[model samples]
Target: MRGCSRRAGRAARKRRQKCESSIQSVSLGHQLQYVRLRKFLHQRGFTSSLLQPALFTDTGRGLQTLKTIKPCQLIISLPESCLLTTATVLSSYLGQYIKSWKCRLSPLLALCVFLVCERHRGEASDWFPYIDALPTTYTCPAYFADGVLAVLPAGVRRRASEQRRAVRELHSSSRDFFGSLQPVLSQPVEEVFTYEALRWAWCSVNTRSVFMSHPSNNFLSGQDHYALAPFLDLLNHRPDVQVKASFNDATRCYEIRSVSGTVRYQQAFINYGSHDNQRLLLEYGFVAPGNPHSVVYVDADLLCDVLRGDRSLDQKRKFLKENNFVHNLTVSSDGPSWRLMTALRLLSMPQTLYRQWKAVLLGQAVCEEREEWSVHTAVTLCQRLLQDTNAALEKISDLLRQCDPAVREQLDVVQSLRQEERCILGRCLEALRGTVRQPDEALPCQPDDNDDDDAVS
Candidate 1:
């Protein structure tokens, strides 16, 4: 029996090893493209070989270190020649048309146009390998379908709409410029520069481009700070990772130095400037789960509803707006943000204490009664948010059941976002409840009818 058990255990180990080997094989399937990209970069002076493209189970596609990289080591240094910038566009076949155009083209639009034109050229283009390595379809809000957009949280959905509108307006305004490209293209300008084509190009540039400031150019309408770095852009963002990236004047290459060391064969990361999950999803089409910077934003309308019975609602609203405190009110794991608490404190004050508004803003001590009122108001607001978040999550679950596989993927992102907000709200509520003397009676603030005579004070 002991001999049989040992044989069975050895067989199981063999099966596990085979499964892992197959998974590794599948993960590196994109090596061919990376190979071509490496060759392309090497010819143009990309020398650092510490990192290589690999599929990470957690981050999808990211750069993994080929060797253990020590802190402060230079991880990548791509020569300026390898970077695709507006300068590249200005020197291309479309440069003459762009230079002679009646109005100057924005740096962003120029990059989009260049990307679209080169993508159209395919294998014939010089930057084909770099362009080919780009994601074919980005998950940025600009690419989200209407159905997917509808399920997003109110704040995210609003921003998503603005993003879509901006992309559409850009496409509409560039028709004349696109037409000017006809002399160089085999296909009609409309066929080559369709809205979808421009949208794809726009997302590619927006999501992946690295910042590289270029000197002022008369032909470009905006700052020339955008550059599409080929293999370097593959470094995914992690909130904890720190890196110093700059254009090294001495080296004549765009360099990224690791402030944080990476383990061998592990995914290497760079910090993307401490972005919240909301901003990450909106701008980059992905969210960092448990992002420390994440917060649940309090909508203005909802806040007003929570403070509906306050006699000085108008005054408080104007005060908040004037102080720039009307926006960015949020709840995080710690509790209500200072801005939200301050807003609530001012709004919860009785008519008799109306003159103390400025003192409240300055964080002066409020009377116990007023403090309790503010706490109650915050608790009420948090409960409402929790209710709404729970309802939205349930709705997303239902939609997930009905959605196709493609839509399901988009819905999943929205679900993750909502779930994070829910967790934040729950924590905020628990914290608020613990502070209330009569937690059960922590009702919404009501208009002080007896203090009406002092309302004008």
Candidate 2:
């Protein structure tokens, strides 16, 4: 059977009151939608009796076990009819009009269009319950209010602005396509295709969809393929948790297995990748404390800034460009990635030493002699980053002190984001500062200049 997940309805027996909403703030309509969706899934044999979706203080509404569950247990199973695959939408009546979309647009975009139109169809739509259950507000930084954006670190704010721009472009492209279909589309459909509606629908799909291979023999999608699994969306994220999710052809359903088991009353979580909280916030609209993938994004531009206007900096710039060491640097949970630290070390090296290290940078040799100043150089670079981070924090602090109540609520999220990233950078900087240098310790080697290992092996 497909290892599907359904955690909405109460079990057969009367349940404890602890299952009540933690905040008691969930709308009655939302609770009713879940009840209806669960009823529908149960009638269709796609729900489990052992667990139900419940509100948790830390994770909003997620699946919680009502009964003891063992590992590899059949959590829930949904048949082909319930699977929200590309084929599901593409095969719909309106879905046929978009055959050209298959080639012209992404399958994700196709699904987004399907979701928007179907949602506008309301009760006439097949997935009303699921649609109604989705969160009305997304908390990702990209969606942060203007005041919030005004107070954030330039790096994070820049990222958010870029993402927002990209989304706007996506919405525009989709709207143009919708306009082309105007003659064939009904009035309600046309209205729903507006940029605002499509934007909401796209975020709905973007935030909740999961990759599930289409099970039909004719469908040849894989792990990268996506579908909007009903019960699965209710599971909150845990950075360390993993899912063994796939479609089982013989059973004609999609199945899911959590890497870890849940006991009665404990919430079950799925891994949204090892994404640090920053990624979680940006992509998933929520941030987890102490995310494992958390890191300080050390911009390549910062490294370049130091090199600009210095003598022979031209040569160093050429070397950086030739070597591709100038981009994608990060101070991650594991400390500065090998590329960043090593690049900083070489950048710290005195000119003649760097000439010798040119062979090292170009990958022609392995293991350059570690100069006494290498640690000092790396520390200096890290300190520069820290100084920038601190200045950004001070800017935010100044904004918070202004006490504009209207923006303060929104700024809370932005402030937390800044502090979190600052924490990651601070931890990384402190470690880099304290490293007791092994005199003549072998400088970590880049692969041979001719080798491809220079690409972050």
Candidate 3:
């Protein structure tokens, strides 16, 4: 048995090497830009021999391992001088203007401005190789077309709208700041800092920047904490990978170490936090098909609508709001989230038992009858959500047929989001159904001598 196990392991290793060779063979066509980026990084003292840029079939472009990485191994250590931070912008030729300008600029805005300016410089800019490698456009909700945005779940759609508005407002408010940079530019400020240019730069920073804390700087408005880590940002997000990333004070480099090692030739990933599909789609422009953290949110207003006939609606709403349970009510595969179930329990209580509301909130066992009502309410809400999800999916399907390829891609992302929500709702509906008990099986609540709360009219 030991001999057979050893032979099996050797066979598996051989299979991995063969598969990796095929992956590398196909990736050669896509390495031109990355080759330039590598040379640029090496010139500036950035080194990572363990991983190389590769076009992955599953994750598009990401860092691939050349050898099997062991747990707790340092994956990449990027030198501080190579990072594009607000400090980098401050020290550049634009520094004097930024410092002398009467108006203060935000750290994020400064990064965006520096990115646009550097991008405009083309091959003339020292950072051109890095800039050239970035995606020309991003799929972040800010870039989603109106028709596509309309199909997103209501909660995500609202947040996307807010993001778009913020970007537009930022562009509008920076006209004076852009004008101030005319001294450093050969072209007019209007031409160099066009809205489209700024939008691209804004999305680049939003999607790719790493959080690195820097001490207070008077020239910048907010905290100087964001840094755009080149090459390192190529490590795509995986909801399951465990990694430790931070700026090493002694090494003077930003480093990421793998807690869960990756096998040879596979895409090496880093955790971008435990983000749900909605958040990942909104901010990163992609969806993890089976993200463990995915959930379907129950909108507060929708919950109220479902319990519209309840007499204690006003009181329950006030209580839920006061207790800070008014938001983040959700449904997962495991059934209703605690907050959602708790809210439903309070809403399920009859007016006669209004005084027992505190007990219910405190997690005291309510009468089985009340519990049944709460389960029934949850079933009805989940049914409504499922219906809405189905309807939205139908609309998306129709839109997919009529839209062009570009629009179809965006619609596809929204479709994935709705479909994931539908699955969660189905699971919740199933779980809620199983918990529901018939009225005849319900037991009476024990009486409390101090109160008559158990007596139902």
Q: TM-score of every model? A: 0.90, 0.77, 0.89
Estimate candidate 3's RMSD in Å.
6.1
Ranking by lDDT: 3, 1, 2
Best by lDDT: 3
Off by over 4 Å in 2: 1-30, 100-103, 150-158, 180-190, 214-224, 307-309, 350-355, 362-372, 390-413, 436-457
lDDT of 1 by residue, 104-150 (tens): 99999999999999989998998998888888877788988897888
Q: What is the lDDT for 197 in model 2?
A: 69
lDDT of each prediction vs. the true structure?
A: 0.80, 0.63, 0.81
Which regions of candidate 1 deviate over 4 angstroms?
A: 1-30, 439-447, 450-457
| Candidate 2 accuracy as TM-score | 0.77
- Angstrom error at residue 18, model 1: 22
lDDT of 2 at 292: 59
Candidate 2 lDDT over 1-457, as tens digits, reads 0011222347611232244333232222246788888876666677677667776665567777778767777776667777676787768865646655434566667787777777777777778877777766566654666666766555667877776787778887666667666655558445767666666766777778876654443222223377787776777876555677777889988777866577667776667676655566567766665565667666666766754534555566567767887766677644677776666655544455554566556444333334334444555556786686677667767777886664564465556666777677667767765563555664432212122222121
Query: Model 2: which ten-residue window has the lowest total lDDT?
Result: 448-457
Q: How much does candidate 1 score in TM-score? A: 0.90
